[model samples]
Target: MLEPEMVAFVERTKSLYPSDRAVSTVVEQRAMYERLAAAFTPPLPDGVRTHDAPFTSPDGHTFMLRLYAPFERERSSGTVLYFHGGGFVVGSLASHDLITARIAADTGLCVIAVDYRLAPEHPAPAAHDDCLAVTRAALDGRLPFGPLPASLQLAGDSAGATLAASVAMRLRDEGVKGVRGLALVYPMLGVEPQSPARETEADAPMLTLADVRRYSALYWGDQAGNEADGADSGMRASVSARVAWTIPLEASRYDGLPPTLAIGVEHDPLRDDARLFAERIRAAGGQAHAPVGKGLVHGSWRALATSPGVQWMHGEVCRFLSDRAAE
Candidate 1:
């Protein structure tokens, strides 16, 4: 059963975006996604300062990097590379500014949120390449931060979490070390259509099976040379071929991944993605814990201000990062 507040929130969302009309075109869909993200994002917290900077990927693709710094009394706790969630098709620094700011304030860490290139226009490998390049730069102390600490962590929500996990896998594959932890919030690991959660939560609020297919198609369709709708073109085949690292859940080896906290919602279609990933990490002899929120739906993080459960989850994430930093 969904919480009353969550149920109301879902109803409001449905009202805002009625299912009667089809959202045509990439522009229309992207606009709807941005509006949804902005609607749920709360005001920026006090004591948190944010500024934008320019970052260039290894492939010469330049993008904006939003830095959220909290006023720490002593020294900074650590640095976190935050990737905003929008299913790789939509999302911006503004969309996730509040969450990033909260992370910085709660963790006392300098948070650099990457505004990676979106897909369908930019396509696959574009977003992943940019994320990987930025992650590499952050790990190498080449980012705006002057000095590095041993407590660097990676974090993201939904599709962003997929990217975070992928980057961790890539870094591990390359023998790059010093990544202390990963914080994944309701991640979408591009699971097969027949997955149990897909069948069980077919009508889950915020994200349904149709929404999943639509978003996946938009990001991985054209790149795979499929003329059909992004969803019609089996995403797994195209996405896996374009960038195998993007599919962290199916990665051949997960032995070297750092301690990870995978948080998911009870009714989310992607809940299995988080749980199975954590299980895989543990099976590989790594530390990975997944906590599923009771009666919550997908994208509950958006209710950070209004939902006590979400607020508590935020604190848990901060605590996880801090504890890993101390290790």
Candidate 2:
């Protein structure tokens, strides 16, 4: 059951999104997202300490890193290196402000939300490079995650999760294994060119396949020299002999990964994406979280402060993270 707050949350959503229905499009989609984001306000409290600092990428594009830690840091745990999901185009740390703050409070860890360079301006390796760079910096010196657990959990929803995967792969490639865990939320794992399922879910609420197409164009470009294909389309290159940017799919390729938990929403376009990856992790001999968020939707975890579904979903997330920390 949704918390009582969820009722009001749904009502407010109805008022804000007249015909909250997604439509088809390949252009002008970014403007549509900007409109939706402008109207959406997450109701969270104040007094949470946050710092907006700039970090440099290997390619030299500057990223704005927002650190959200508890006001009372005397009792902090570890840290969550998060990437904001906007399909590599639209979102930033500011857009996910309340979500990051709540993660800090809920998971008992400082959440570092990275504002990676977006597409149409900076593409491919630019975004992935920033995520990798920051992860190294946090584990190296800048962040206050003193000798963090052998593994720092990398997390994010949608595009952010994709970046997190990239970071994990890079770390593995460089023979680094400091990541404690990974939490992925309905990650976009492939280059959805003309997949039948993608075409079918073209009108998912809040995020449409059409919107993804436009964002893909902006990120990967037209494919005819516009996109940094290898960097943007992570599926194009294998991170290892078996797994690429994702955990695994062939069931036999899931070795050497740290503990992992993947959360999926029933009413999301990316539902199967999470399920397939978790299955791969389990097949590879790593632990995978239970059934993906039952009866929930994409973006539910981030909606914890306002929506009922979000509270339930995040409760499960907290439980999963707590269990991992205990292990």
Candidate 3:
């Protein structure tokens, strides 16, 4: 059952993004999503300041990175590399500004939000590669921002969470160290046929299961079948080993990941992704904390101001970052 505030949050969200409206093109989808993001984005928290800087990836692609720093902080405990969620197609640095700003202010850490390339224009591996490059640069203190605190962490939501997890795994494989923690919020890890939430919460408010399949197709450029077929395609299978970059669940091993906090909202189809991911990490002898937001739905991060469940989730994230940064 949904809380009254979450119920209102769902209603407000539906008004901004009506299910009845047909958004046929990627442009339409992106525009609508941006409008929604703007509607819910409040002013930055009182003690946080943000600035944008240009970053050139290893492949010579230049993009923006927004840095959020808390006011009057002598030294940040660590830096967080954040990725925003719009199923890899629509979200931008502006869309997730408030969330990152609050994290910076609440945890006294520097938060850098990546403006990675979107899908249908720059498909799978493009966003993943950009995020990986940025994380590597941050870890090596090679980003233009100059010397950062030695401690670093990866954080993201939805598709962005998938990128964060994959980057953590890849870095582990390369034996690179220094990532202290990971925070994933309602991550879309993969399309597993038997995942219970995929069936039970298929039509959950905000993000339906069909929406998940459509985004997966657009991100992977998988047109082998209709959007309803989800991510199960010949091309996806052909590159399963490499596909882990886009779908973290495809990774063969979950060992050696940093301490992780994977938040799964109860009413979200992707809820099981977080749960299963934590289970896999623990099975491999790593530490992971998977918490279910009792009455929340997908994308409830936008409701941090009004919803108690969202507030609790945010608190959990802050504690995770603070603890890991202190270590």
Q: For this target, which candidate reaches the highest TM-score against the unseen true structure?
A: 3
Ranking by TM-score: 3, 1, 2
lDDT of 2 by residue, 1-327 (tens): 334554454455556544433343323444554554555646544546777777776567676887776776546566788888878877767667756777776777767898887776775656777888889877676653334333367888888877786677668667886777887777775555224436555665555676566665666554423334456445333323222332223223556666767676655566666777667777867877735555555555545656656777667656665556556
Candidate 3 similarity to native, TM-score: 0.93
- What TM-score does structure 1 among the candidates reach? 0.90
Q: For residues 95-153, could you state the per-residue lDDT of candidate 1 as single tens digits?
A: 88778988888878888999999977876667878989998898777886456454689
Off by over 4 Å in 2: 1-47, 144-151, 193-200, 222-253
Which candidate, 2 or 3, would have the higher TM-score against the true structure?
A: 3
lDDT of each: 0.80, 0.63, 0.87
The lDDT of model 1 is 0.80
Question: RMSD in angstroms, all models?
Answer: 3.7, 5.4, 3.2
Q: In model 2, what lDDT does residue 87 have?
A: 84
Off by over 4 Å in 1: 18-22, 148-150, 191-194, 222-242
